[model samples]
Target: MSQWMTLFQKEVLEMWRNFKWIWVPLTFILLGVSEPLTSYYLPQIMKSVGGLPEGAIFEIPKPTAGAVLASGLSQYSTIGALVIVLGTMGIIAGERKSGVAAMILVKPVSYFSFITSKWAGSLLLVWISLFIGYISTWYYTGQLFDWVPIGEFFQSFVLYGLWLTVILTVTVFFSAALLSPGMAGFISLALALIISILSGALSNLLEWSPSQLTSYAGVLLTGGELPSDTMPAILIALLLIVILLWLSVFLFKKKELAA
Candidate 1:
């Protein structure tokens, strides 16, 4: 337990050294704030561009606070996910490549402690960043539009946070299992895309998949009736996270053995 805490502290310091603690949260805050700002000022922006014909009546219906917040979540689904992948793709793979992993493992550290520490550290950073960004978006949404109910907003946050957890776990698994950071990132992104596509194409079949978490979040935000499978989807996502972490530990051990 002490070793894990030490390693986890190391991970945090590394993130700080890399400026992740600065840029990641800032990037999320910007991404979150952009949606409400754009939605509110889009007409003025259009008029400034002067692209429309003379006397053209360009009318965009004002979105509800829930819709605005949901749009912000959609941004996270794409750009936010990409940022997370890029940030974490090298956590284990880079350590191995640079001989850092072997150096650490050669000491009194157990493999489980090593892997779990990294996982916990990375998850903490990602979740904190997401929380900052989402809260900023929610604040702006309330200011520029109607206030989203606190209960519904909280529910959506949890659901989207779960989807992000799944993505981060997949990235960590590949980072531990693969030799190349680029390959790990590529495969992780590809898998996320495929899951999302599958979820959309076969909604009924994959109602329990982690990919459906984002959709369920959107429903919560918009005050729509959640599907009967919401609980199942949450359970499946948690299960997937556990399995991936376990695989990550196993693969990390194997990789070290082969070295």
Candidate 2:
């Protein structure tokens, strides 16, 4: 218990020293604020930058607040996910390369403690950064368009956040298992993309897949009628998170640390 607490504190301090606590939230806030602002001003923006031939008229339809929020989430799905991937890709691999892993392991510390501490720290960062960003998005969306229902907004956030955590967990697992941070990040991103794309293409056929979590989140945000049943996807996603974290611990325990 003492070692786990100590390692958790150390992981947090490392994040603070590295300035991740500052930049990661800032990045999310920027994305959140920018998405709504751009969506609201898109028509004016297009007109200002127009090279339309011969007095062409382009009428842009204003999007609802929920649509704006969904668009913001779409941005996070791509750019925000990439940022998280890069930020965390090195969590364990970098430690191994620097001999920090070996030093820590040489103590009486358990591998589970070491890996879970890192996971907890990374999860903290991910949740905080994403919450701040989404709150900013929700606020800006309300200001620019109609306010989304508070209950629906909260539901959307929880669902999307689960999907995001799954991605982060995959990255952490790969970071523990792989030697190269780039490879870890790449594989994690690839896996996330594949899941999303496949779920999208297959739709009802793949409704049970974890990718549907993001889709469910979008539906909640957009006030769209959800599928009659989606509990399976939610359950599957939660199961995957548990399994991946377990796999990460298992791999970390089996792998030898470099000195």
Candidate 3:
């Protein structure tokens, strides 16, 4: 336990040193604030751009707060997810490349503790950053649009966070399994895209998949009928996270032995 804590602290400090704490939150905050501001200002923005013919009566309906928040989640689904994958792609792979993993493993540290500490640290940063960004978006949303119910807002946050967790776990697993950080990130991103595409194309078959979390989140925000498969999707996402973490540890040890 002590060893895990120490390693976790090291990971946090490393993130701090690398400015993950700064930029990740800042990026999310920007994305969050932009969604509400843009939605509110779309009419004026369109008029300024003058894309329409002269005297064209272009107007946009005011978006509800729930819709605004749901759109913000979509922004996170693309740019935010990319940021997370790029930021964390090197977590384990970089350590191994720089000989840090070898040094740490040569000590009494168990592989479980080492890998779990890294995973926990990375997740802590991600969740905190997402919370900060999402809260900023929520605040602006209430100001520029109708207030989203607090209960539904929080539920959406947790569901979207779960989606991100599955994506991040895939990145971590690849980082552990591969020597090249670029390859790890590429494969992770590709896998995420594949999962998303398949989930959408076969929604009936994949109702329990993690990718459904985003849609479920949108439903929560919009106050729509909750999907009956929501709990199953959540459970499957959690299960995928666990399975990936286990694979990370196993692959990390095997790679180290091969080295």
lDDT of 2 by residue, 26-61 (tens): 999999999899988898999889799877889988
Candidate 3 clashing pairs, residues 3+ apart or interchain? none
Identify the runs in model 1 with alpha carbons over 4 angstroms from their true place. none
Residue 92, model 1: Cα distance from true site in angstroms? 0.4
Q: How should the candidates be ordered by TM-score, best one leading? A: 3, 1, 2
CA lDDT of each candidate? 0.91, 0.87, 0.91
Q: Residue 194 CA error for candidate 1 (Å)?
A: 1.1
Candidate 1 matches the true fold with a TM-score of: 0.97
Superposition-based RMSD of candidate 3 using all C-alpha atoms, in angstroms: 1.0
| Candidate 2, run of 10 with poorest lDDT | 221-230
Give the clashing pairs for model 2.
Answer: none
TM-score of 2: 0.95
Q: After superposition, how far is residue 152 of candidate 1 from its true place, in Å?
A: 1.5
Task: State the lDDT of candidate 3 residue by residue for 73-190, as single tens digits.
Answer: 8888899899999998999999899999999999999999999899899899889999999998999999988788888878888999999989899999999999899999999998
Our model 1 lands, by Cα RMSD against the true structure, at 1.1
> Mind giving the per-residue lDDT tens digits that candidate 1 earns over 88-174?
999999999999999999998988899889988889988899999999999999998878888887888888889998999999999
